[model samples]
Target: MSAHEDVGELVPEGTFLRPDDSVRRFAGGTVLVGGSPLWLLKLGAQGARVFGRWVNGGEALRRNAGEQRLARRLLDAGLLHPESPRGRFTLADLTLVTPVKDNASGVHRLLEATDELSERIIVDDGSVEPLPEAALRHEKPLGPAAARNAGWQRVRTELIAFVDSDVVPETGWLDAILPLFSDPEVAAVAPRIRSRPGDAPLERYEQDRSALDLGSRPAPVRPMSRVSYVPGAALVVRRSALAELGGFDTRLRFGEDVDLVWRLAASGHTVRYAPESVVWHDPRAGLLEWMRQRFEYGTSAASLSARHPGLLCCAKVSRWSALSWGLLASGRPVTALATAAVTTALFPRALRGRGIPATEALRLAGVGHLGAGRILAEATRRTWWPPALVAALFGGRARAVTSAVLLPCLIESAGKGPSWALLRLLDDLSYGAGVWAGCLKERTIGPLRPQFTDDSLCRGSGRRLPASRSIGSKAGRTCDRSRSSQRYERVGAR
Candidate 1:
């Protein structure tokens, strides 16, 4: 029997389909399951069909020896996993928790949307008006983090779900997300929050693309990856797990979700973003509301940086790339070019432990810098134009840069309106402003400071630390991913 060979196990009943994000088919009969965990397959028609069958929920075929062997290959390739028994848990196993301030209509909407559960608890966080019949009132307005703690405390269920009052979970949301906890190490899972469409442009802007919406990608919620934070808007958490960690931080007024997820990751507990299990959220359509929300979000950066000193920077991106981005943003095309050259020239020092030749690494770094330069320029146009403007006026460099920026906008936007690049710029600026504000308030440049990761980071002990402890480590010191955060209570993030 192979590593995945388990005769007693049943196929995963929940959301277990093979994600199609990185499956590539070529002119030859070769396929690659390429992303994160990567694999290559030189498949004949029969092999291809076999792979498709498993992806499409063909568990019955597992009885056959040939099919089981093929399945083992798939599992080893990081293409699929055997479904854990759904009998392990159900909708009734998790308790529902909703925290509210004064949104009676929002609470009503949430109550209506949630499905069958053994227990549903609502924490009324300092609501001025009389409480709704369904709510569990708390006289004082504890922030969301504290409110969540209050709700989680009353229930003794195995799992506790925290849903923001404004969110309405779609049908099948539980069945789709609950199975993720089959891995006992998984602390929590959050569903994607889709924006509810509004009458106005900003509202419509949010509907198509909300700041909270993290898109359809199943990713480990870690420090610097694509899916970093799982929003507290809709979460299904293992009660024992949160209980051991002391629940949500009462100090966090905003970004409690980020703080919780990051803490879990650092402590070696797994957190996943399940985009398939979705909820509709009422977005801030008004400009003032949006601005206020983003600014508040920004202020949390200083706090998070202070808490997790070494974890806030880009984990995998090279410094050359970061410098190129900044230089391009400031309109210094020459300086940006020189910076990339210098970084490449010092490849021995700049690109150590990267496993690639210096020249090859330099080329890769250059290409990445060029791409980021365009993005930074667009993002900075609204903030400030730099000395590069004078150079752009003179030569073909201006035309070349303009074409590079506009060409991508036209192609990627695909009629989505106002180019995604421009939209991204606006988004970054909003968050950047808040970061600046927070820095000003704290009288620190921590947010702007870079915290680079060393590939060779280790624990105080001479032995090499496990991979989990490394990615999960703060200050690049080896620590158990699932160990208690109590020892480092201040190293929390949002």
Candidate 2:
């Protein structure tokens, strides 16, 4: 089926849609800016009118096919999201599959929390003490991916919920997530995994910024997007989709969840991150364990890069932004300012006919550069820190750049106190060390590569518009800018 047909099927009648937090309307609501890598959408007279109505909290009903098509287009572009899923399926259609190792106590705790769910299966991955409640057991300790595959293979339910033994689902967690299965194209949906509450300092940090938690925003799971991959600690998957894809890659002990999510997206299936459905996960017992866990996560980067090349990168930035930062790092502040000014000047020119005001264009360019700096700094700390540390030791321009990169992190944690900042530093170092180790073991530098792209405004105009012919028919033929603006005003006024 065509991409449009697929999206159309996914967004049926009665589906409530909301714009992404990144979405911003300009040019009297005729232009939209949002999506991963940022983008701009210029709407015609009728298109703007329809968009305004729906964006102002109206539903995309079947009666207005134009609005529905527009919603579909925006959704596919990642500009819109399903506000709340309304699925026909119930808990009876789901089978909860928990993969356990030697943590029988954890299994018991999880089972007690979810006792209401009758269809449950526990897969014992060669635990020293066999779990009496386990429906499937392995003689040898298979990795989590293999154990999950074993459990799901024996399940007859249409949907399978994979909750790790270490996780405990919040009450009524499925209420918000189960309905997402109403969309046949969605292969999986993950709940937000928050750290279990505790008074320890490390526990507090984990609660504030757990790596497993993908923030509170809802988003379609895709590589390079805000929520790139969901944790396997708790997620619901369609049995058919898993079977078609041959389940997770058992070869991978780490990053199997990321690999599976990426594969599902590549095969034209949707995976969603539903933060409204919360689940609690126990943080590693102590600081050492926490650091070890972060390191293991970093080690997966090389394997993930091997499986999906180009998707794993240290950083992605625009050429101009990179040049500006490079100039600043080299002590050419004046030159850096000039370069930034030039970039801001070009933004309006690139989007001259897109209905975005010159002021908004300039603001977007500035904001883009600021965001790029953050990305570069994060990359330096996470993947490039080893070389950065070496350069810092030499005490030159590299030292200055390294200090600049680390300053923001320290300042952000300042409010929390010295201990917090120290922990944050350790966190980055541990992860960066693991990344280097993984690269060495795999004999590939793919994970360390940086990606640079043309300015997003220059690329946004090329995005395909669904039912363009129909939209053109309703909006009338485009003319000069003056005429187009007048038409937009007329439609927007209504």
Candidate 3:
């Protein structure tokens, strides 16, 4: 397949370079991507000239052999934007399901929010106050996973829409996302779960940084892609796929959504995240409950790690970001500046897989590490961050440290004060603590182990990387970096 075949057109985080940006003149033209080296293009004389023209003229492409080659390379690198294909699928074929417990008001709000659906199933998982008569009541609480399975069994449509009662889906969510199932391999598609209105700082902080909200980027949902697991809160799934997989493992009360998605990918199916499909979720307004919810969400990670091992380890640290933060926290301002050097060097290293080009692999590495790093970072919360925060603040590197840690939070905080950012730190600590708790309960450190492809094992075995990255480019056919590559580790049972 060509580079454009599976590339999503919308890259929310603007590439390191774009059609419009201030050009910095130097001895040679150089453009860094995500602060890494120019993986978008080789930045040779010809490529640099083409990029300069596009940058100055606000053009994403030019029609010519050399320019087209560079453009395809850029597209493969996720720098050039492709046209996002419009989805076309009938809503009538979809069924909406949400598992609820003591969320009558949330359920009511959802009723109004997703009025477009004709068949909506609200499986009442033993609500305390007793849900309204309109709900499909289950006498006993079977947990969210089981509750979802109960509802899906009744669906006759090709697709099922699962929305958490706590969230209110914005208009056009179904329209924007349901079409994703047009691809037979796609088992499910999840929307962007935005934070609902909250009166307190913690709630406000979650608005910009809700644990459920994957940033606004549309990508295939896989074990470690832009979206690993779509939250159980909301999803549009193909009915037959769920049935074939025995629905969700009804035994899992928590992280069932994760289990389902990972299972789908594991079984050679596709899942996706559509940021345009917005679902506003009302996160906990109180601190105690908020922390508890985070803790609960974390317990699910240990469970997921056992089921999906390689995805949750520190080795999945896809980006060089935490490294910079580490140096800053160590009171080594002089060293933090070298982060760019460290990151640029690793840019080519993530490219070592058989079929994936260096540039595309780097992007995928960012996504994989991002998904993996969250788990790894949370695991470290118990031992790091707190002391690092103190040392940075008191050790006279507050300005640099703050920028490194909370710069991204600033956008999500939506102008909330430092308390919001502080709460984020506490949130990680809470989740990290939960991982330890889960490990204790499970009686294994399997939750903390890292797994990656050792090409040496595959070489003599004549095995290949998973089907996802199995497609090789002509030029990349000879590209071999298993010795140097760290990302694009093969998936499936060891």
| Backbone steric clashes in candidate 3, count | 3
Cα RMSD of predicted structure 1: 10.0
Ranking by lDDT: 2, 1, 3
Every model's TM-score: 0.68, 0.91, 0.66
Native-to-model Cα distance after best TM-score fit, residue 246 in candidate 2, in Å: 0.5
lDDT of 1 by residue, 188-283 (tens): 988889998766656666766687899976665666545767788888899988988899888878767788887887776667677777888888
Output the worst ten-in-a-row residue range by lDDT, candidate 2. 485-494
The number of the candidate with the highest lDDT is 2
Q: How many backbone clashes does candidate 2 have?
A: 0
Better model by lDDT, 2 or 3?
Answer: 2
lDDT of 3 by residue, 238-336 (tens): 889989899888766678888888888777675666777788888886788989988887677677778887765533342344455456566875786
Error (Å) of candidate 2 at residue 32 is 1.3
lDDT string, candidate 2, 257-344, tens digits: 9999999988888889989999999999988889999999999999999999888788887777888988988899999999888877
In candidate 2 the C-alpha lDDT for residue 359 amounts to 91
Best by TM-score: 2
Q: TM-score of predicted model 1?
A: 0.68
Error of 2 at 80 (Å): 1.5
